[model samples]
Target: MQENKTSFSQRLTLLKQKEVKQTLVGILHGVERESLRINPDGGLAQTPHQAALGSALTHDFITTDFSESLLEFITPPEVSIDKTIGQLTDVHKFVLENIGEERLWSMSMPCFIESDDNIPIANYGSSNVGRMKSLYRVGLKNRYGSMMQAISGVHFNFSLPEAFWQEWLAKLGQEANKDTISAAYFALIRNYRRYCWIIPYLYGASPALCGSFIKGKLTSFEFSKIGKGTYYLPYATSLRMSDLGYTNSAQSGLNICYNQVDTYIDSLRKAISQPSVDYQRFNGKKDGQYQQLNGNVLQIENELYSPIRPKQPTRSLEKPTDALDDRGVNYIEVRALDVNPFSQIGIEANQFYFLDVFLLYCVTKPSEFFDSHLYQETETNLSEVVNRGREPNLHLTHKGESISLVDWALSLFSDLAEVAAELDEANNTNQYSAAVEVEKQKVLDPSLTPSARILKILLENNEDNGSFGLNLADTYKKQLLATDYQFMTADDLTAHAGRSVQKQLLVEQQDMQTFDEFLRSYFESSTELEQV
Candidate 1:
């Protein structure tokens, strides 16, 4: 452990040199936030994706996820965290102003869903690619049920700028090339997997949920009940990230390797191609309508359930793995964040600052290659943190030794503080270190964590999760609607909406092949990379 610490410190010191430090300013960040639209009564909205908001298939910043009511707001990559948050806020403001009589659900978990069928699958219009996109969601619904698909979260996209990569390559005495850069990212991923439990520990907010979420299902958790069918775990942090949410039993045995880009792409490709006995009953089609894209372990690479993923901007009609296979990793997406209910925009600027520091720490630290045992340990640690992170005296395995969660977190914070300081120095602002310090307080006092605060608010008010979330949704909705747009004008959004509709129509008109032909061509093109 001492040797590892020394190596990490040495590398960090090297990166903190003036030449390398200047490049750090260019690190880019973006966010994709998902939220369900709910009616005035707090029930999941049954309306289709708002047409005035723009085509779900062609919009650059707004779209639907699995459900038609599940709105996904995207922000373009920006070097400044404040600008990124501002852009996200502008998008939210535009959406709220357009969608009448509905509020965006404030929590990561869904609102009062009565049954699986109550959730409507997203529709993406008649273009081949668009239809295929909706069908993929159909596949998700058939495989995992719509209740699970209704859950929402935030995805953080991060990439180091080319200037930083150039400096980093020189610092490590490695060639400046795509492969080397990708290899460095994999090392960062390995470290991230080991310590990422701290994210949910600090920011996880779904400690309690409406019982409607699991209405007809049986769960093993010994849950405590609140007003009128709210279920909660007293010490839980993020039940949204637990086995109850966003998990795949079917892919539980998949051993996707992050040791190299090749291994990762190959594993996802195989998963998409491999047949599944469990999904075969769907037969891919029913009553002459396609029920799913295919009867495979995964219909496509996007179906793979993971907390983090290497990502590349895909070309039109290109598969994600194909893009990675062709160009290596461009950035990484962190998908474990629960929506911050307290924030009107579903995320806060300080969270981005803290993540910037933590991710830099992941890259600076020396990482060991993951073997099966180490991977299993990471899984165990994450499971422990998500389920019972706030429990006093909770111990997690660290390199085969049991360490108290608070102790381990404080140790990590010591290292994070150094990285945060370096980031603050690079950016000429104290926000990074301030963010780290704020998170450190949560580590010391679990009651300060978002998850604990959420449960406390619910219990103290004698309210159920549904009522608490509804109140927040209503509050945020009014606040967003009343606020003026900062980054985008209402007229600008309207013009973008008009352009997106035209783009969708052009795509539909340009389609020369039938849906069957399009699917066949897509699969053929996707698998042709196997020959390469």
Candidate 2:
């Protein structure tokens, strides 16, 4: 740990000398929250995408995640954290105005789901691409169950300025190219695996869940009874990130290498191409209706669920890997964050700043080559934190050795303090440092963590998962409706929605192939990753 401290300190000193503080970091933030409408009897809302939010297929900022009820709000990359948050808040405001009696679920986990058929799959318009999108989700529902598809979280898309990387490359005497930049980002991912468990330990809010979620699934742990049909681990942080969450047992054995782009792509390619005996039963159609996209382990690359991923925006009909192969990683998406139930918006600005620092720490710190054993170790540590993170003197593995969670978190924060200072110096604000201090307090006092706080509230209220989340949902809905849009005007938002609807109409009209032909071409097509 001392060696880790010294190495980061030296790197920070060099970074300061390069005077890269003014480099503007861009954030492409998006929040995906699944909610149920407040009907006479509380149940999952069976509603279509609201007309006010625009077409789910063509909207840039508003779309459905998996279910029609699951609203995902996206914000374009913005340097100003305030504007970024403001935009997201406005999206929520717009949505609330139109949802009528509906309320967004404050937590990451879903409410009391009756059955898989109760949840409606998201419907895109009548286009080949749109049909493909819906078919892929049908595949997900067939393979994993609709209940797991209802699980939602916020994705933090982060990218540093190219100038910052160019300066670092020059300082390190390395060539500046897509391959070099990508290698550096991969190194960052390696380090992220080493310490990202701290994220759920601090921000994980889904410690409990509705019993219906686990009704048909495996149940081996002891759970304290809340209200009717609700159970939670006494010290659990995020049951949503646990094995019971979005995990697929088939993909668990995949030892994907993140040390380079090619290795990562190769592993994903093989998984999607390889056939799985478990999924083969669902490969054929039922009554001449396609049950799934194909018999492969993964319907597509996007089916591969991970805590983090290297991302590049795809072109029309282009695959995720196609975009990545065409250009190196444009940004890294941090998918571990559970939507903060406390805030009206899914995330706070300070939370964004904290993540920015943490990601920067991952890239700047020295990273060793990661392997299968270490990757599984990362999963083990994360499971421990998610299931029993608040347990006194909890232990986690670091580089194959046991260390107290608090000790490791504190040591990591020490390095982050320096990072915050440097970023503040560059940005001419103390917000980054202030955010670091706030997170530091979470590590120092476990009670201050969001997971702990949520558990405490539940215990005090004697409320179950459904009742507690419903209460928060009502509160947030009222708050959002009361507030006006801060970033964009109401008319501007409506105009964007209208235009997106028009765009979807145009795409439907321009379709050249049948859904069947399009699906076949997509699978049989030989798409190659662009080499540098």
Candidate 3:
């Protein structure tokens, strides 16, 4: 047997390495312990509902406030069916214009977050799924473009610059001042800077919009009561792709990410054009990635300047994952796909294989800045997935040329299957490949998408007229209520929360807790680095 004698730090570093390819896609919920309600006064109301937890850092029960009633209200009507590219672009514009664009983004990523309220839930990102499905009813099937604007959720890799934060804290004086809402203002600003501004009520209900904090004069309270780092925001990315069927599970999200997220980031970079940090400020890109309008040059502040902060990137090729944050590196975000209610979690063995392979593809493929033209095309894929997926023959732009959706999906699925098989063989886990084949068959078969079934039931909802979201919201609440509340012991928390869920949760939970508090004694209750 191999000698298990690695030192603690070495083991931690190794664990972090194992998590590199995983990307956090927060499994999101609209309502938590306290579900938010939109008061007629344009304020947010946090109902008594709250997500229960034994500690701030771990979760034994996964709960959400998103109600089925809400899901129905958000589902788009089954109209405006456009099938071609030109027609699709028009539909995309229609959705974006109506959606009132302005959203969040990640660094160097070209996606957007359109301003909308209440979208569908449940296996949302699979196969062009979600409340936005009705665009086809109007002959405006600009597939991906429309889906892009109808985003639902977000995931991120949080990087807190402790020293920069300290400087900011000093500037704010850690207390409410005559300037009014200075700390809160800056907190929101920080949230914006880190792409953490997925405001809870941005779509409709917002606690901050109506909470006592809005009325108070900023007493001795810390900003973390709202959340720790970043909160996963709803109405930002969840689009049920499964309903469109035929293996297009990521359409809804891919649309939102590439369309809304990408454009919004570009807009933001333009909005905050002043020099906050040059390219160098972003670490390994330490050389400062831009030139000032006045033609001045820049570079990152020396890493020694903020030893408490994550170490600055050492090489040009360094990734954000190399450094530590409240959460670790890019963690696995299993998109709730191939909604197998039989599994309760909606993911199946084959789906897991596909995920592993798909992740490997994302990592191995050239993710280098894809050109701007590709963004819209990516969005269109969602619509194609939603409306045309099951048709056996579909079209998509591949490497600058249009190709069949069936062909593309099949190819993509096959590649993923291969990767899963390789992973199994390498890990001595053939079961992984078996799972891939199982899911591959399911994808080939036309089945009910989670949203489809939910919407079918949603039509029966009495609250809203035609919204399919109520079902999902109810499901979320039900899941939360059903979650095992027996607080896991410390050991159990360690077992479940090593890196994956933390990455998933952190993407939505950044800027939730302040760095000072995040690094404080309260968080100490979680565990030492070794335990995670």
Predicted structure with the largest TM-score when compared to the true one: 1
Q: List the candidates ranked by lDDT, beginning with the highest.
A: 1, 2, 3
Clashes of each: 0, 1, 97
Question: Which regions in candidate 3 have their CA more than 4 angstroms from the true location?
Answer: 1-350, 365-369, 386-392, 451-532
Candidate 3 or 2, higher TM-score: 2
- For 1-532, candidate 1 gives per-residue lDDT tens digits of 1113338868988888998899899999999999999998999999999889998888889988898999999988999888898889999989989889899999999999989899998888998878888777778888888998898999999999888888877887777688888887888888899999999999899999889988878889989999998999999999999989988888877788877888888877888889999998876577888888778888777788888999888777667887887888899999889999889888998899999999989889988777888888888999999999999999999888999999999999999999999899999999999999999999888899999999889889879999888999999989988888888889999999999999999989999999999889877776421100
Instruction: Pick out the ten consecutive residues of candidate 1 with the lowest summed lDDT.
Output: 523-532
Q: After superposition, how far is residue 332 of candidate 1 from its true place, in Å?
A: 0.9
Query: Lowest-lDDT window of 10 residues in candidate 3?
Result: 298-307
Please list the residue runs of candidate 2 whose C-alpha ends up more than 4 Å from where it truly belongs after superposition: 1-6, 24-42, 526-532
Clashing pairs in 1: none
Model 2 residue-pair collision total: 1
- Better-scoring candidate (TM-score), 1 or 3: 1
Task: For candidate 1, give the lDDT of residue 204.
Answer: 94
lDDT of 3 by residue, 74-146 (tens): 1111111111212222222221122122111101001111221232222211111111122121111111122
Report the candidate with higher lDDT, 1 versus 2.
Answer: 1
Q: What is the C-alpha lDDT of each candidate?
A: 0.88, 0.80, 0.27
Candidate 2, 269-324: lDDT as tens digits: 88888888888898767897788888888877877878899988777666777677
- Once model 3 is optimally superposed onto the true structure by TM-score, how far is the C-alpha of residue 516 displaced, in angstroms? 18
